[model samples]
Target: MYGCEWDDETGATNGFFQDGYDGEDFLSLDLKEMRWISPVQQGFLTVQKWNKDTANTEYQKQYLSTVCIEWLQKYLQYGKSSLQKTVPPHVSLLQKSSSSPVTCHATGFYPNEVKISWMRNDEDHDEDVDLGELLPNEDGTFQKMSTIRVTPDELKKNQFSCVVEHQGKTIKKTLTDDSLPIGIIVGALAAVVLLVVISVVVFKVYQKKKGFKPVSASDDGSNSSAHSDAKA
Candidate 1:
């Protein structure tokens, strides 16, 4: 492999050309000395032959130092738009249940650099906190999750929040009762109500199909006896 390195801040440049054999260093080009160096015995003859070729060595040096750097700069210029693009993260607080840890989840961010932490009463809190790994999204974005274990009472007595830092922006999510998985409870209640309504409908349909009539409590015995006399 051969390449050039450029330091934009320091305006420093360096180049190297190295060859390996069977995962071991075989030969390397020394730009400063304008010679080939061989660390292994098998490459000694090859290095000697290469070092004697002054014209080829000069060309190699020129390509590594000048031409390679020019191509690298051109590539960087051509892809600057995508290389420097930044997308802010969308963060949320999630929990499986009241007894579970609260996770600060951030997703749909670009560049994959992010920081997640917990804060209590406006101060950093790291106890019982677990930081998750940065993961990739299907849309070329990134995601991460950080969780904190705290009791319900602690949440009520103090202010707890999840903070995420990405793309020079800060996002915070405060722990609230609304953040709890109350939707699960509401969904369960709704299911029970639906079941009761279905049962009532089914029972009414069965009664109608069986020709069953409901007896009223207001019917008198005299009315019943007159009906019987008429029948006689």
Candidate 2:
């Protein structure tokens, strides 16, 4: 394997060139000394032969120090935008049921580095907390979840919150009835109302198409005679 490393802050660069035989180190280049180093006796002869070629050694040193560094810089410049980008996460507190643990889920964040913890009354709480593994999202972002087990009585007596630290920002979600699936209930009710409205509209359209009219108690027998003539 051979590669170059660059330190942007210090402007320092280094390179390495190595060869292996049968899963053992055979020959390696020492960039500082401009020489080939061999760890085993079998490679001593090959190392001696390579060391005698001063012209080639000088060429190798120049290529590793200058040419390799230039290529590395170009690659870094091409990928700078994607490598340095940061995206904040969307945080949510979720619970399946009253007896289940509350999960704090954070998703759609970039860079994959985050911290999740629990707090009680503004203080850190670690008991009965489970930290989930970092997962990848389909959009090239990341997601994570942390769950805390607490009783309903304890939640009502104290303020419990989930804290998420990501991309230099902090998000806190408090445990409350709002965290439950209330939105689902509202959506279901809305669907039912919509269905009732549609049914009423259809019924009115059918009545209109069939030439139906409201019959009042005071209507004369003329309306009944007209209906009988139409049926005939």
Task: Name the candidate that leads on TM-score.
Answer: 1
As a whole number from 0 to 100, the lDDT of residue 63 in candidate 1 is 94
Cα lDDT computed for each candidate against the true fold: 0.87, 0.88
User: What is the Cα-based lDDT of residue 175 in candidate 2?
Assistant: 87
Please list the residue runs of candidate 1 whose C-alpha ends up more than 4 Å from where it truly belongs after superposition: 1-4, 14-62, 182-232
Tell me the tens digit of each residue's lDDT in model 1 across 1-232.
Answer: 9999977689778899999999999999999999999999999999989989999999999998899889888888898898768999998777767777788889999889999988999999999999999999998889999989988888778899899888789998888754646546677789999999999899899999999765444468876676666668
lDDT of 2 by residue, 90-128 (tens): 998877676678889999998999999999999999999
TM-score of each: 0.62, 0.58
Q: What is the lDDT of candidate 1?
A: 0.87
Instruction: Give the poorly placed runs of model 2, Cα more than 4 Å off.
Output: 1-7, 10-69, 177-232
Q: Candidate 2 clashing pairs?
A: none
lDDT of 2 at 46: 89
